[model samples]
Target: MIRIVSLLLVGLLLSCDEDVLPKPNSFLRLEYEKATYKSFDDKEYPFSFQYSKDAKVIEKKKYWLDIYYPNLNATLVLSYMHVKGNLMFLLKDAEKLTFKHMIKADDIQAVPYENTQSKVYGKIFEVYGNAATQIQFHATDSVSNFMTGALYFYAKPNYDSIMPAVHYLKKDIVRLMETIEWKKEEYF
Candidate 1:
């Protein structure tokens, strides 16, 4: 009887050592660098606004620029085109650009933004899921200057992984929209 009891105790101990139960899923805790913004205004440029100091402004060509976030592996592309008389076409092009990610995106939500005081009116698109560009917007004076911005990450479009960075930059974009001032002289 004592031998049977010992065997039972040993079995219990072995079972405990084996750890047969599955471990719960866990995710890495990701923390991103804090952001601080500074005003961005160039006499040559038609508009002025604030942007994250963490990002570098790269001018591809005159009036065409990119806000690059190296640490976050992202870039906000700013495309400038003369409206001339094709405001509808410009608006449509911006919409098409935002929706291009629909094949990979779970959803795209447009949050309307209008700063009547600044004369910047546009729609900000928040894209969910694994899309190439997660955010985009267009600001126009509805005459000569039409500018569109799109936020794209360098890495693969894994929405879950980059959400925090996206959230942080979203605010910077909002600030940019809020502060945009179109130069009457710069307009063509």
Candidate 2:
């Protein structure tokens, strides 16, 4: 009788354990589309780009802007900064600056890798950590946009859990980079 009771208790515990385990979160299917808007800095400045309608643009000021891409009802933030100099120069500067900051902060483990580079345009650097993964890219076009800009994407702590959404958003960001057009004028 004790052996049968023990077996029944084990079965009950196994069933309870399954119930306690968290369910996998569902992800939304992103519908991407082309988007554009004038420069928030100056109405006369004609800054435009293609992005998803699901994404919302938040222009904090003349120099700073953020594109929030929502996933599973959560906001994934991609920030853009307009800087002086050519795309290559800006990227080199950013690498140096990021390295310096990481060293100073004692975050040596946060060192980034050049994930990829564009012989035709720019490069992307990806930094991973226990808390988040940051992907930065730079690009410029002589025939299209004149300004050098940086794109930053910050994902959640455990990237594996959000891999699907992260991948989708990364693709969206790439499209945005391709369509970026800076207005004529040195805001600096």
Candidate 3:
């Protein structure tokens, strides 16, 4: 009986030797609604483009617009300037704005865009890192119309956290740039 009891205790001790570990940390999966786009055609403005219906276009001024994405807590600040022999200045300023984030950005990729048929030409700068602005772009007719846009989030700079939203909005920005239509000189 002593031998049997000792064997049973050893078996019990062996069975209980397994380590108890806390559950591994799990991450939240972020998902956003499917995007739909709408045309932005205001005769009052010199240009028109298509933007995601998910965003609201608030006219900050005569030629300035705030494309607000409420669900994502982000905004695309767009400003328009008549070339008036200041095309170089506008382009330089747009590039300057993009490079301002170089300290925090791992890389700044400038994607050149040109639609010869529409006379729309520009460069879309993609800033990778924990920068305040993840995207910046400038479009110009090289003669009459120039426009610049910058993407900004309401929260602190967290690249990993905001990457999804940035990618989604980046598509929208590219769509807007692709669909840009400059009104006739007489319309201005």
Candidate 4:
């Protein structure tokens, strides 16, 4: 009886050890050390932004840039595209070509623009908590259109891990939108 009880105790201990340990929080923490900006001379137009040193600028096309904002535990991706021509026309083209694709992919919902002309400035939409936002701002001369769009996604979905970094990076996005200077030369 003593030997049987000892074997039972050992078996109980082994079973307890087999129980899996709870995993640590998988969420990542992001660090926004500093702000950096860059512009490519090879393109027909000039584009600039304030970004983190760890972030990468991916050139998808001659005129498009995919700015990858890296978080210690999340990802923030923004795409900037510059085009010249009728502002309304370019926006429509983007809606059909780009925005529609996102909707089809179930990344975003199909929403119409809500035009607003406030005392400060004219904004087409008041996108709230959106996964993405596209803006087509006409140049001061109204001769060209400057388009910059951003796609926001949580890489880890841990709000605690990414919110701070995202908040800091969003300021850069606002700065880029407010300070866009389009090139005078026409590519096409």
Candidate 5:
């Protein structure tokens, strides 16, 4: 009886030697394929630009388009407006749209872009944190054309989870801003 009790005590003591710990939370690892770009030139639209081939462009209206990324579950919403003496208002509206996310955004960085030769001037707004839109930009010819784009994901705005996708699409946005060309000026 004594030997059995000693063995049971030893077993209990050994079992308590280490405090069991819950495993650390594991994060999902996401990987995406390299992006290939293609030019989008339509005679109907005032501007033309390049976009990722992985995306499908859907024309919403005469001047609006939705660039859908099926793999990333995101969309780049593009709207082209005729700048008829209301360039300031158009630009102000674009900036207003970006700042609307300020409540949820941790930071908003405005990066200016100017291509004097191409006559494409714009500002790209990078919104950091779990905001509704991760990126927003506007390109204009300062004469007759204005274009604004916003990047949105289908999933809930979890900045960390969607950061990889945001980074990928951001390159596409920059490319679009860089390659945008205004066909001609048709002032009203």
Candidate 6:
């Protein structure tokens, strides 16, 4: 009787099996350090603004610069063009360049900026999706100076993986536009 009762208890304990459950999908959380800004005032350019201290500014040529974010693997290209009495044309070209991404982009929203005191007027484009470039903008005093900037990621344009970086840099871009005031063109 003792042997039979012990065997039955062992069998009952072994039969109490839990069912295997599937887990929900997991996502990779990438965190970046908080950004700090500093004045980017260089005599080489007609305008100056604040940029993230986290990025390295590379001067490609006179009035042409690249703000590179090493940790995010992205670069902001600032290319300057003389207005030459064609402000409308230049504005059209900038819009066209950004629109080219519409094929791959989910949507594009334009945010207009005007600083009457600084005499700066421009539009910042926020692009959504896996497009090659995410943000683009044009800042001009609307006379002698016309400058356009575009943000590109060195890594493939995977929007999901790069969304955090995009949002982080968006603030920097807004700061840049806010502080980008035109200087009196130095006449030689």
Q: Worst ten-residue run, lDDT, model 3? A: 27-36
lDDT of each: 0.88, 0.48, 0.93, 0.46, 0.93, 0.90
Model 5: pairs clashing at backbone N, Cα or C within 3 Å? none
Global CA lDDT of candidate 6, please?
0.90
Question: Per-residue CA lDDT of candidate 3, range 1-188, in tens?
Answer: 99999999999888886688999988777887777899999988899999999899999999899999998999999999888898888899889878989999999999999999999999999999999999999999999999999999999999988998899899999999999999988755
- Residues 43-88, candidate 1: write the lDDT tens digits: 8887878899898999999899999988888999999887778999
List TM-score per model, in order.
Answer: 0.87, 0.51, 0.86, 0.48, 0.86, 0.86
* Per-residue alpha-carbon lDDT of candidate 4 for residues 1-188, written as tens digits (9 for 90 to 100): 99999999999888785657898867455565667665434454454334545567677776676666555433333333444556676556555544443432334333332222211121222122322332222122234334535445545333344446556755655554444544544554
Q: Given candidate 4, what's the lDDT at residue 184?
A: 46
Worst 10 residues of 2 by lDDT: 111-120
| C-alpha positional error of residue 135 in candidate 1 after TM-score superposition, expressed in Å | 0.6
Clashing pairs in 4: 28-73
* Candidate 2 C-alpha lDDT tens digits along 1-188: 99999999999887774445678988765653534333233353446656667767676555445666553333434343444445455556656644543432323232221212321245444444333334455554433333333333354355455545555665665665555556665533
Query: Residue 120 deviation, candidate 3, in Å?
Result: 0.9
Question: lDDT for model 4, on a 0 to 1 scale?
Answer: 0.46
lDDT of 6 by residue, 84-151 (tens): 88999999999999999999999999999999998889999999999999999999998888889999
Q: Pick the candidate with the highest TM-score.
A: 1
Error of 4 at 172 (Å): 1.6
Which of 3 and 4 is ahead in lDDT? 3
Candidate 5, residue 45: how far the Cα is off, in Å: 1.1
- Supply the global lDDT for candidate 1: 0.88
